[model samples]
Target: MIAASDLPEVIPLFPLPGALLLPRARLPLHVFEPRYLAMFDDVLKTPQRLIGMIQPQDGEDEGLAAIGCAGRVTGFSETGDGRYMITLSGISRFRLGERVEGFAPYIRAKVAWEDFARDLGAPEQDAEFRREPFLRLLERYFEARDLSTDWASLREAEDERLINSLSMLLPFDVSDKQALLEAPGLPERREILAALMEFALHAGDEGSEILQ
Candidate 1:
């Protein structure tokens, strides 16, 4: 249970395009780049083992999107060859504030948590939302891609868990992924994901190549 006050005002930002971390979800990262390796080392020495996962607007030189989710280091392992394999547990989404100079090699940003306070706890389910349509679309999408998934596990997942997990796992375009990250709530995110999946399916049927 993380309180708003417990979150830091400034956090090291990891700007990887198409990578998203919704609250309560887990994101695994492999850190090999020198700058991010430095960032990882710095975080290891801190009491707040947190990092902000954001997507760059364009290339790494370009600006970052305004919103990103904060994740706390929950698992970590280091290779002898100088690399880090870590897992982060999502905390909450944050709106980026001004960038600030920080000790780490990576960029750090001041963030506002007011817009996503609800993310600290379990998401509220929408009684009116239908899961069948979304599930059907997902099945089709997986089949089209020739991806194998555990159906029993997916069926047993909670609504929020299912939606967020799929959103992170599916290979959507960068912009589409950002849209899902910025969605106001779980239901809205689910709707946006379904729409994106449908659009991709239609594009494939029209003989247009779909981006994985």
Candidate 2:
């Protein structure tokens, strides 16, 4: 029941490549890095417990993408070896604003939440989603990559969950994941996702043809 106004103006940033966290989706992470462990330590002290899950720009590891999602630390535990097991439940996507300069080992930035205020609302729906056709495409794509998934689970999931989870779990390029994150709504995200899967399938077909 959190609102945009209740969100913190600034949040600690975790720059990870190929990781996508969309609104209403949960992402589990293993925190072993020293700096990130410190980041979680500080984040736990805050009331909101939000962390900006961002991607490092495609080519360079240092610069961050312009858009990123902020996820609340909804689940957390510490392992015996000082590592952390945490789950982030996405709240909203925000535009990266000014980077806060400080001595903190992790990155923190001032974020603008107005553009994605819808993310704070109820789960989104894609009325135009064609579940059967999309599942067919997904099967071909997964078969090409030799990947396996639970069919029953996918069939039972709502539109947003199915698409967003695939967008996060798929082995698409880092830029692809960022594009999915930045999509304005569920429909746009679905379009980009289907396109990406189709392209992968086509590319695989071409590769097979060449080897034949």
Q: Candidate 2 regions off by >4 Å?
A: 58-61
Q: Per-model C-alpha lDDT, please? A: 0.88, 0.92
Pairs in steric clash, model 2: none
RMSD of 2: 1.2
Q: For residues 155-189, could you state the per-residue lDDT of candidate 1 as single tens digits?
A: 88888889899999999988999999999988899
Candidate 1 overall Cα lDDT vs. reference?
0.88
Show the lowest summed lDDT stretch of 10 residues, model 1: 203-212
Which window of ten consecutive residues has the lowest lDDT sum in model 2? 55-64
Taking all chains together, the TM-score of candidate 2 against the true structure is 0.97
Per-residue accuracy of model 2 over 1-212 as CA lDDT, tens digit each? 67767898999999988889999999999999899999999999999999999999744346899999999999988899999999999999999998999999889999999999899888899999999999999999888899999999999999999999999999998889989999999999999999999998888889989999
